[model samples]
Target: MSDEEKRVLLNNAWCRDADASFAFGYALRADKFGIVIEGKCAKCGCAIVRCSY
Candidate 1:
């Protein structure tokens, strides 16, 4: 996926989590392999999700 698309997806995901009052933070990284996302729940500072496309 393109960088822009990855960014939009990450933003949407984080917003959804926030709307639910589930504190979270996410990072979108792109490289030769592909797009990858690493997310953490701020409530407990634990890794909650990871996605690649």
Candidate 2:
């Protein structure tokens, strides 16, 4: 995904390190309904997923 889209997802995801950015683990997955982004919080190292339609 583009940097802008990644930024939006990372900003909106519910993560412990709210002030930090995220490091994407894989490419985005899209289904008929929406998109799924899987990654980890840069600061806390916790797994996170952001889904968007």
Candidate 3:
């Protein structure tokens, strides 16, 4: 899936976006750097947690 499409799924989970734009406020800003999501995901809406480093 594409990045935009991934954002759509994230939006569905967080409901951060409802306009189908797949854009969220947090997406523009990052509290920490070098943060990443590991393991297989993006098919069943897994719980991808991110915390500040």
Candidate 4:
């Protein structure tokens, strides 16, 4: 990994895709009562997949 990547990792700012992070979507809650998204790729949807060897 590069020094910049290392710095970001150390700071817990690492993300898989910067563009995808901006991609927003909405879905009904389990109770189907109301919306839950705050207009960002976060909450229970924001995820970062990493592989370790």
User: Which residue pairs clash in candidate 4?
Assistant: none
Residue-wise C-alpha lDDT for candidate 1, range 1-53, written one tens digit per residue: 67787556655443234332124446666766666666665555555444455
List lDDT for all candidates, in order: 0.53, 0.71, 0.36, 0.35
Q: After superposition, how far is residue 43 of candidate 3 from its true place, in Å?
A: 22
The deviation in Å at residue 47 for candidate 4 is 23
lDDT string for model 3 (1-53, tens) is: 46785554454432222222222233323345633332222443333433223
lDDT of 3 at 47: 37
The numbered model that scores best in TM-score is 2
Model number with the top lDDT: 2
Backbone clashes, candidate 2:
0
- Residues 21-48 of candidate 4 have per-residue lDDT tens digits of 3223432122354322222343334554
Q: After superposition, how far is residue 25 of candidate 3 from its true place, in Å?
A: 18
**Prediction 2 global C-alpha lDDT:** 0.71
Count of backbone collisions in candidate 1: 0
Show the lowest summed lDDT stretch of 10 residues, model 3: 14-23
Segments in model 1 whose C-alpha atoms lie over 4 Å from true places: 1-23, 42-44
Ranking by lDDT: 2, 1, 3, 4
- Pick the winner on TM-score between candidates 1 and 3: 1
- For residues 1-53, what per-residue lDDT tens digits would candidate 2 score against the true structure? 78898678667776665655566564578878688877777767778777898
